[model samples]
Target: MADIGAAIATRMDVLPITRTHRRATVAVGLGLFFEFYEVFLAGVLSSVLVKEFALSKAALPPLLASTFVGMFLGALLLGRLADRFGRRGAFLLNLGFYSVFSLLGAFSPNAVMLLVTRFFAGLGLGAEPPLADTYLTDLLPARHRGRFIALAYTLAFCGVPVVGFLAKGITEGKILGIPGWRWMFVLGALGAVVVFALRRGLPESPRWLQAVGRTEEADRVVAAFEAEAGITEQKPAAAAPVNEPAVPPRALLRPPYRRRTGMMVVFHLLQTFGYYGFGTLVPLVLTAKGYPVSQSLLFTAVTYLGYPLGSALSLPVVERFERKFLVIGTGLAMAVFGIAFGYSGSMALVLVFGFLYTATSNVFSNAFHIYQAEIFPTSVRSTAASGTYSLSRLATAAMPFVLVPLLEGAGPNWLFVTVAAAMVVVAVDVAALGPRTTGRALEAVNTDGAPVTAPERAPRQ
Candidate 1:
């Protein structure tokens, strides 16, 4: 069965680019579009909530941390749905779960109620990016996998600038008599609802189906893909299958995987301070630096242009270099730009340094997401990725508590310096331990050099 799974991967890896592939990428990418919208909305909205609702210092952290706390639990507890139930089902379930809570969050009468709903929404939102990564990784061929993943994210990351600009234009005012922040949540929820309906058209992951011994279903899905790609040639039949060894949930804690897991765990924990730290805190950081709320929102919106631009720029080169090196190189760049962003007192320098940091961060994001999805075996891909990703969520949830005071007491300069230091650690962690993953099949990367096929066991007498 494992050999059959490997063969299915080979078939997928060789198919030419076709509409079927593009359709899958778009379907998965749309979910991510709203997922990012929901995630970044907290930052934009928080800037307004403090003024709109007259929130005090004591009341703000809970509101800021609420959704991230939910995300931590969701990623930690629910990420295995893809590994256990199948990717297509998990896609529908998560989007639907989050959208409802996001809608409710829009109607909350108070900050406390809003955060509660945001937390529930976070539960579903947390699983989305990991699921998108694993699903796309399974579907695309090795030759252009990095490019497609970066492409999908290019579409998805448009949400960041959209939210940034939306907040800038409306967050301090109203639309149809409703508060702009509430409108932002409603917009994200509605977009997610649309993506949920579209995702139903997706096919289950053939690699996952084969890994779980559903070879017939896997064959049908791959056959449909081949037909869509107009391939007439077929590989020779696979040999008789052997039983696949069970991958325990604890498998990530053992030897070959253990070292990889440790590196990822450390990377994720520290990386949060740089990624989400600067990302979600930008508005507040500018505000704390004595800028008005309006100016802060404007800067945030302009800076967010880097996300989609970076993802688009990465498409041409995503597969050209080792992904680990991209991760390391970009992390160092982020540290440099982030520190410069903090020191710039002039608006032009602020926008320039901020845009540079945001752009490089997206490239870093693209490289690491593609890297992590390819490193783990299909049997535990979502679980391991989610488990490691949850730590980042956990750290992000704690950022308000930690970063808020640092911003207040030490000022934006030291705060961004702290962000720079975290990125330095991330660069070190990856440089020391991360593996090369560009242009390699998931199976080969996970198994060290080539696909592993266990010998067949004799039937019971």
Candidate 2:
């Protein structure tokens, strides 16, 4: 099994980018697209719902927090299925789970029902990203792993702007007498279905197969990739001795992993304040500043263009810089831009800083997502990543209850000041404790789930 696993890892690590790789990345990315669509939709859709549902200020927090709460449960519960079973099956199951409940949410008659459905939808949505991070890290070659992962998320983040613009238009009018916000739910459900179909052909992670002692399947899958890359004519290289023994999930709390796990937990806990904290509150902040709902949603749509654009911009630099430095630099940038955004009175300054703030967030986002998955071993990659990721969900889930009151009482500047402080904590946490993963193979990063000694650094551009 060790030999087989080593062989599988070697073949995958050395292969050039190929059509097979792109197909798999796209399949995973499409699911992420819809997951984020539903997640971000809450902010815009909830703003309209405050009026449409005749929601009391008291009811608003529960409605907004429902999705993240469900996600919290989903990541904690369902995320392990990928590591315990296989990545491909979990991929299909999660999307199907989210689509059904989200469709039901479109027809929800009252706040309670909508909240319930969104929670269930979130259960499925929560696991999608951690699963994506695990699967992409397992599948992509180390040579340009960060670049390809960014490409996957570049496609994924497009969902953010799509939801924003769709909300801009859809919230204004009815489609077939169904309220526009409800239509957003219907559209997310439908798009997820399409991605479900598109993902049916995605191959299981070969590394996972080898890890679970399914060596024959692992070989066949790697062989197919080798053929696709037109490298089958060459002799197989001697397998390196695999040190990646099956480490139990509990190992994350012991020794070398304890520090890594602690770093990620703090990072996830604080980072959301910078990312989703700002994202979810932007419309409300604009509204507080006296922009009407229409203008708020419009400005949100324009600023959100940064999500995909920032992800695209990261592709060139993601591979060039060390992941930890990228994460640290972007966190500081988000704090600066977020403060600028909060202080701006002019519409022009608001748009410019809002766009910059959002763009920097995505770069921050891309760097950390890639960083998280790479830090763990294959046996517990999904478990560890999802476990930490669940913390982010929990933070975002509680964000409305905490930040909403702050926004109301302290004003947008102080609201942003809170977010900036959190980002600073994230920068410090990652800088002090995060490991170097740039271009290193997983086995080298964490040997037998223990901390690895310094490995060769990725060559600089």
Top candidate on TM-score is 2
Residue pairs clashing in model 2 are none
Per-residue lDDT of model 1, residues 1-461, tens digit only = 56666667777776767687798889878888888888888898886788777899988988889889999888876778889989888888888889999999889898888989999999988888888889988888777789998988999999999999999888777889998888988888899889988888888998889877798899899888888766666644233322223376698899788888999999999999998999899998888878898899999999999999988878877888889999999999999999999999999998999999989999999999888888788889889888899899999989999999999999999999999999999999999988777876666677744543322211111
Worst 10 residues of 2 by lDDT: 452-461
Prediction 2 TM-score vs. true: 0.96
Model 1 spans with C-alpha error above 4 angstroms: 235-246, 449-461
Q: Please provide TM-scores, in order, for all candidate models, with all chains considered together.
A: 0.95, 0.96
Candidates in order have lDDT scores of: 0.85, 0.88
Scanning candidate 1 in windows of ten residues, the lowest lDDT window is: 452-461
